[model samples]
Target: MQTVEHESFGSPTEIREFPHGHAEILNVGDATIGRLVLEPGWRWSNDVKPIAGTESCLAPHFQYHVQGRLGIRMDDGEEFIAGPGDVTSLPEGHDAWVVGDEQVIVVDWFGATDWAKEPAGNVAAHA
Candidate 1:
């Protein structure tokens, strides 16, 4: 048997909004993908930490930078900047922010399913 599925961010299955960014999620086959649009000044530690209720981003992401720049700092103090056409494999326990004044757009192949959602059984824990 063969199957093909098509999905688009234009009509995402879910949209997760945070302080300075949003993630549009799509479910195609067994994969959950996300298109994240981060405005300038959007920082994972400052924006998504509250909703995630974790000290750092715990979602391990394999993403393609579509536009703008994104600065990432791992918990181990490693840092780098990703720009358009860059592909990044980010493990859990890292903080990221948009670099410069350009809005950042990324397509995440991994870690989108629960990227900005609260942990299980901890609704509004940081509110």
Candidate 2:
């Protein structure tokens, strides 16, 4: 049996920030979760790519859109939009951006533990 635990994103265990976006991470048992707050005009490639050093987002995400809207484009060119109340499982190698003027908030059940980690040799950038 396992002991029950309670956690809050309000005082996250970890926080990573980048241009126009940020992720607040929490841990429960063996799983890690993140609450991402992406501002309007935030884009994975444009904001996070410099730190990630990847052509596209390589973090596989299983997420719930909590508020506002977001757009995703896969490396292969497939594109879609996600709004509040939507659940999405995005594979690696994709780009995501906030849609319209709304700030997008999402809860990621996967990929948060390693997302937005500072790139090699980039000291104290974000994490």
For each candidate, the alpha-carbon lDDT, in order, equals: 0.89, 0.89
Q: lDDT tens digits, residues 20-125, model 2?
A: 9899999999999999999998998888888777788888899999999999999999999999999999888899999999999999999887788776574322
- lDDT (C-alpha) at residue 68 in model 2: 93
TM-scores of all models?
A: 0.93, 0.92
> Which residue runs of candidate 2 sit more than 4 Å off their true CA positions?
120-127
Candidate RMSDs in order: 2.6, 2.9
The local distance difference test score of model 1 is 0.89
Give candidate 1 misplaced runs (Cα > 4 Å).
Answer: 122-127
Error of 1 at 20 (Å): 0.9
TM-score (C-alpha) between model 1 and the true structure: 0.93
